[model samples]
Target: MERIILHCDLNSFYASVELLSHPDLRQTPVAVCGDPTSRHGIILAKNEPAKRFGVQTAETIWQAKKKCPDLVLLPPHHHLYREYSRKVNDIYGQYTDLVEPFGIDESWLDVTGTLHLFGGDARALADTLRRRMRQELGLTLSVGVSFNKVFAKLGSDYKKPDATTVISPENWREIVWPLPVGDLLYVGGAARKLLGQYGVDTIGQLAACKPDMLEQLMGKMGLQLHSYANGLDADPVRSRFEKEPVKSVGNGTTFPQNLTTRDQVRQGIAMLADSVASRLRHLGLYAGGLQVTVRDPQFRDRSRQTRLSAPTHLIREVTETAMDLTEQIWKPPSPIRALTVTAIHLMEAEDTYEQVDLFGGSAATRQRSEKLEAAMDRIRGKYGSSAIAYGAAAPEKEEDPLP
Candidate 1:
């Protein structure tokens, strides 16, 4: 039997969530943006009205304001957004057990087994889902229904705000083929440019290209794109419980001001390493390697990685290694703008045991550190994040804080 997949994408998620409180700004241009006074100023999401004026995500607030002068900027309520995401996914649980979230705002649901319980029609089910979301959550979604995940995602993108698009085996070629090759799954800018160079501008042209010929031109990705274009995608929508294992845990931040001193750089690394280690501990994972990335004032990023003697999820270990790695690549007073610490080469803590070093003292120190950090985690968990902090990792107070 052919699978039934539905991709539900919440329209302008951040902006839409903001509008729930300020409905008066619905018809006007609105955007959710970060504080410009801090270096973190950027448009996170824009509403349809703002988008109509060519406002885009990730662009600076200054650029967005220049395009849409009347754009009403609202600060993000991340906790509220997470609450809504949980509620939305709870509603999806009613339809099927096979629901995979693409992000906080979007999910792909496989309803092949339970479609008849609601209605046999995929389009009707999609419309009903959208209506329920709007009426219950004051949010809207665009849904795509198809036999496969790729086409289902494309169907969601085929329309806007609150609508459903269906791509069937019979009508897929008619509805999807003439569209640009970029419309196909995994066909990003690089792939699109390569396809264009070979006169494969449309999905039809891409589908018509011989797989072997495409492989010769673009390697493995070419073959994958050709398969997606030809509607040969058979990838299953994984159940929520079947999420992929963690490859790496990382945290990064752009500082409020350029970090010109070694102390400031150390503080940044310590802060990021603390976050990465905390997350790793929570997940019961340990890192066998550490990766650090340093971004300069020019926004050029340089990164380096080093393997650990053994896996660890301790903040002291992560921070010390990250600081050493950062020092190796960066000669301080270079004006660091941002820093990231990533825990890589992960392994389940339960599956591995800490080994005693050949020298002996290092193993006892690690054991002591683990017990101390575990207690610290419990303290922070109960008292809140600000209740505890490492002296070196503490952020310096800003002279004039953004309001």
Candidate 2:
């Protein structure tokens, strides 16, 4: 039997959520942005009114303002956005157990087995869900209904706020083929440019390309794109119970200022490593390797990964390892715009045992570190994250602390 999938995307999620509180701005051009003074100034989302003026997401505030001079900029409240995301997903859970979240503002639901309970019409069900969301939560979403996940996502993108588009097997070839090949999933800038060079600019042309020739042009990705264009996607939308296992835990942030000193870099890495380690411990996982990525002011990134001598969930160990890895690819006096630390090669805490070294510290010392970190976690849990710190993560604003 053919599968039934629906992709739902909240329209201008951040800006729309902000408009809920500022109802007067509903018809005004508005955009959600970060503070430019902190070097985080960029458009995160824009409402329909702002979109009409050509405002776009991720562009610098100045760039957006140039197009929409009357644009009203609002600061983001991430906690509020997360609350809405949870509420939206809970509503999705009402219709199917196969609801799968794609991002904070998007989800894919497999209603194949339960559509009958909701009246057995994919387009009707999608429209109903859209109306409920708008009437109850004052938010709008575009929903795509199709026989598979990929087409459902494409369908969702086919329409606008509070709309539904259905792409069935009978109409997909006529409706989806004439669209640009770049409209297909995973066909980003590089792939789209390559396909254009080959005169495979449309989805129809891409679907008719020889698989072997495409493979030679784009390696494995070329074949994947061809399959998508031909409507051959077979990947399942994993339910909550069958969700993919967590492969890595990572944290990153754009700094208020470019980091140019060793102390500044250490501080950034330590802060990120702390979050990654804490998340690993909370998930009951240990990292057997550490990966660090450093982004320069020009937006270029340098990354390095190193295996750990023993799997560990300790903040001290994670921080030290990440700092060491950063040293390999980065040097002092280089302006760094952002930093990320990831705990990779994950294993369940209970399934693995620490590897003790003969030349390393004794078992008693290891146990002490674990207990101390655990105690710190408890303290922060009762108090707040700002209540504790160590080494480069210390909250002292006196001066740079690294040597």
Candidate 3:
């Protein structure tokens, strides 16, 4: 019996979500762009028309405009993307919680357990999802149904716009073999260059090559390359909801001019500790380690972490640890660009609360903080996120804050 993994990728996800918000942009050559002026700013996604003009994603907007002069560009809005992601996940969970998100825009569904209840046909279930996405969300999806993660991911990528393909064991060779060497799942830049040097420019050639030759050229990864080149992958379908995160942390930003100084970065770190504690209480997790990251003016990135003597969920203790770690990360008076704080080595908040000495000020302070956190979570749950936030992240309603 063969296993199954169904890969579903939203076509032009960010662009599609934008089209949802601004119906007028539909059918136009729109591109979801990041700051074109920033070194990291580039095209994130775009409509088909833009792609046809050779406007590749991650290409600078200046380069994009050279390809399609009239291209309309939009900025990335993670918050909006998260909203649609939740909506899509809700839709997918209706089918199976075996669903694992591939990225913000793509997900994998293991419907092996539910295939019988849905009429015993994987293709039909995929088609239903495509149509429903079109009907309900006005979005399109490229779906692949195959025996494993490798072929399923390939199936979605193999399709054209708004299409579905099923790769069965019987037809895997014919349907997959002739594809270009670069299209094989594990064949990256180095592998392609090496395979090209060996005159293996297609999947068929790579698959037909002696296993010894592949092992010699690419080492251990070559074994995986040769296997997936012939359509095979055994990666599991992991549930994002079922598995607790190894870390529970929060971060907040308040960069004036969208950039800031070293002191401001420290304050942001403090705010992040508060936000992280709020989340730790919400998730019932505690942090055993803390790290602070800084992006300097030259785009140089640096980070440092410190382990706590004991895990903690208290805001002050985490903040103090993070600040100490920050000193190790940066020598103040340097040109700082952005800062982020992360909590790591997580344990159940219950574990921390139970393991600590029950008679100390640390325990008393933690108990008080947990109560405060519970209150904040309730308010945010009832109203909305940011219903309660660090004073640094105060809101001024904006028409285009997200765009």
Cα RMSD to the true fold for all candidates: 5.4, 4.5, 8.2
lDDT of each: 0.88, 0.88, 0.77
**Model 1, residue 382: what's the lDDT?**
100
lDDT value for model 3: 0.77
Estimate the lDDT of model 2.
0.88
TM-score of every candidate: 0.77, 0.79, 0.63
Summarize candidate 1's per-residue lDDT along 248-273 as a digit string, tens digits: 99999998888767677777888888
Off by over 4 Å in 1: 171-247, 289-309, 320-334, 350-365, 378-403
Tens-place lDDT digits, model 3, residues 100-162: 987798999988888888898999999999998899888899999999887888899998688
**Residue 222, candidate 1: alpha-carbon lDDT:** 86
Best by TM-score: 2
Least accurate 10 contiguous residues by lDDT in model 2: 394-403
Predicted structure 2, TM vs. truth:
0.79
The count of residue-pair clashes in candidate 3 stands at 1
Weakest lDDT window of 10 consecutive positions for candidate 3: 394-403
Number of the candidate with higher TM-score, 1 or 3: 1
**Least lDDT summed over 10 consecutive residues: which range in candidate 1?**
394-403
